[model samples]
Target: MTDSWLPTLLTETSEEGYALAVRLSRTAVKLTQPSAEVRERVRADYAEDFGALIAISHVVATNFHTVAAANGFWRS
Candidate 1:
């Protein structure tokens, strides 16, 4: 895993930024909303973040592959 992506996640500072940063944040909130209800919310948040990260990573990796393929520098 690349450590470089760490800062990109940590640097987000807005509502949109929080949406991105929460994917990588170490913070967790304890719910006042009751166990069953809060459990669903937490699970959904995790699912959403995981999907977003996977999609973003896929796009980035695909772009890198395309660039490398075009350059022919990765041919071996």
Candidate 2:
């Protein structure tokens, strides 16, 4: 991932915010693992693990919290 990724976290809608959160989560994993082959090797382990799924959900939620705050909680 050589693209420049700077999160403004200033989304206009809650749906967009959620999508950003998911992207944030995926990006983190990509950066940490860095190797597609390694990530694919362990994919099944996390894919079938309930705890791992919940952990990822928590990460996305945490990222969303920041995104929401930056957007003023999407207030009108």
Candidate 3:
């Protein structure tokens, strides 16, 4: 995980954060596409990448909530 997006995610509006999270999720999927070598190296490398990708998904969901709240779209 790079520090690059951390500040933007923290400071930008929820909409921006949601966009960024979606982009990150796509990128992470591309990275983890299973090649033979990649499968062999999962313990050494791909596991962390996969974990981070899951974390990004969580962030995306959180941002969705934020956007909904900002727009007064929340349910009781």
Candidate 4:
């Protein structure tokens, strides 16, 4: 076994990523409310941001799986 920081880093990154996802989702909901101004530019920006959040979530999930497999946390 080699001493590598990847596992620790991945754990921290996943935690922060989850926090970011939650915050982003809250902001998206607030922005999309009927009372909020839904201009074309704003709508486009929100869509882009939401897409980025989804990407981040995917990366975090992938990292978690990698870490689990590497640490022998999964059973056959």
Output the number of the TM-score-best candidate. Answer: 2
Number of backbone clashes in candidate 1: 0
lDDT of 2 by residue, 1-76 (tens): 5556863778889999989989998999999999999999999989989999999989999999988888889985
Which lDDT tens digits does candidate 3 get at residues 1-76? Answer: 7666334334245456566557655545556774656546654564568786687668667666655565455232
| Candidate 4 deviant stretches above 4 angstroms | 1-48, 74-76
The 10 consecutive residues of candidate 4 with the worst lDDT sum are: 4-13
* Runs in model 3 lying further than 4 Å from the true structure: 1-48, 74-76
How would you encode candidate 1's per-residue C-alpha lDDT over 1-76 as one tens digit per residue? 6665334322222443434434433222223344676666666665768787787566555544444444353343
Task: Provide TM-scores for the models.
Answer: 0.34, 0.89, 0.35, 0.36
How accurate locally is residue 71 in candidate 4, as Cα lDDT from 0 to 100? Answer: 41
**lDDT for each residue of candidate 4 in 1-76, tens digit (9 for 90 to 100):** 8984233422234455454445544555566674555554466665669787687577556655655554454333
Ranking by lDDT: 2, 3, 4, 1
Query: How big is the positional error of residue 42 in model 2, measured in Å on the Cα after superposition?
Result: 0.3
Two-way TM-score contest, 2 vs 4, winner:
2
Best by lDDT: 2
State the lDDT at 66 in candidate 4: 58
lDDT of 2 at 9: 75
